[model samples]
Target: MLQMLSSLLHHGSSVPENSPLPYTVKVSSRAKNARLKMTPHGGLVVVLPEGFNKKHLPALLQRHEAWIKQAAARIEVHRPEPLPLTENGLPYTIALHNSNEKWSVVYNNQGRRVLDVDDAGGRRLLLSADVADAELCRSQLLTWLKRQAHKHLIPSLGKLAAAQDFKYAEALVRLQHSRWGSCTSRQLITLNTKLLFLPDHLVRYIMIHELCHTVQMNHSKAFWALVSKHDPLWHTHNVEMKSAWKYVPAWVSAQS
Candidate 1:
């Protein structure tokens, strides 16, 4: 009887299980108590409370099947609208980002990396004309972006690591599709290039949070305490990180 029931649960009860239920509710207990969650993973994940019995999980999932399907279908959101085309839509003869003391964009007609700060024009950046090819523009822009990351982020993480006496393996910037940052067991950290659009404070806070993972792998209280030691205002940064996408112009992803 148990084998038959297990088979039914995994394989769908012959075609009869296709019927839909009106509403489904997932009861997840991650910490000490069961907390309601609006959005679970692609299917559903009921995080059981500590010392919870695993035997009753099947029944719980079966009871909420309708709700799972409904929530999944209703809450799906397509990726945001792509950035509109440029005025002419012609591939840029060149696209550039100036990283001299500040950040700004440039267009066709510039040397590869000749940045001349002209004091004469109230301190404006002047690029040379030789490196003005399309490929060179993007390449230079990437290099400039990495340089920006190194300058703004590396030192901050270094200070955070020092405070905790944790040795970070490495820190790198990536063009990931969805993840913001991650910490490996080796203590190496990877940050999303989208972080460039995030405010510097939030970016630093994320770096600190990931670096702290060197000492603590999970989001347990100890891990958060580690983060708070370096950045007491981290909660504000966390909130800002949540809304960071809205502020990022579409061009950043396009360049990479």
Candidate 2:
């Protein structure tokens, strides 16, 4: 039974012996109590507090199987909507709605890579050859998006840091599926490249949230106070951030 439960947690159940139950276990050093969460991106995560016995996991999963199924079903009903494609859809161009930049994608038999970019002029660029495979096209376009984040996000973070009188050792832009951004004890900050899809204010809130962590690492009252001082509408922004994934086009999230 324990082995069956472990399989259910990792692989989700498909057969009667296992049941149609699925979950992921996360052991956190800071968690004080066992918890469960269901998000559109990371279907379900069972957070185990520090020092909690692993032996209790199977029973815990069994107890919550019904709730898990209901929650998963609810998620299926409200999945993020995919971005609409152009009239000529296949091998379509990728557009950054917030950044105001667009790249034309193409596929062919002879090309060095899945995507070969030709950018003679800044305004008009072409992704030449072998992009016919949907996955390859998505990968290449995501790469382009990362480049844009480095080009734009890094400088923007510097400006925000300076304006707020907050200092950080460095900044990194990455494609994070589960988080918007994070700041480490070393003062290194990582911003999600996906922020390019969100509105400016929401993006700024995430920056401010991480910068605040430089002084208060934990999400204690002091940390929140500091965050509010920097970004006044942080609460609203935080709530909005939960649903912001909807803004990301389906072609992109599918790759995630």
Judging by TM-score against the true structure, name the best candidate.
Answer: 2
Which candidate gets the maximum lDDT versus the true structure? 2
> Residue 15 of candidate 1: its Cα lDDT?
23
Those runs of model 1 whose alpha carbons end farther than 4 Å from true positions after fitting are 1-101, 109-140
- Give lDDT tens digits, candidate 2, residues 25-139: 6777999999876644446778889899977877777788998888777657655444456332333555665566766654554555545457765543355545445555557
**Pairs that collide, model 2:** 107-131, 108-130
Relative to the unseen true structure, what is the C-alpha lDDT of residue 35 in candidate 1, on a scale of 0 to 100?
A: 32
- How many clashing residue pairs are found in candidate 1? 6
* Cα RMSD for candidates in order: 13.0, 7.6
In model 1, residue pairs whose N, Cα or C atoms come closer than 3 Å (at least 3 residues apart or on different chains), thus clashing, are 24-67, 29-47, 29-48, 111-128, 111-131, 112-131
Give TM-scores for every candidate, taking all chains together and pairing residue i with residue i: 0.49, 0.65
- Residue-level lDDT of model 1, residues 1-256, one tens digit each, is 0000000011122222343432222333446754322221212334457666756655655666676576555434422333343352212222221122333343435444554434464433344434435345444545555656666566666776787677888987765545678888987887766566555676667777787788898888998888899899988877656445543443343433
Clashes found in each candidate (C-alpha, N, C closer than 3 A): 6, 2
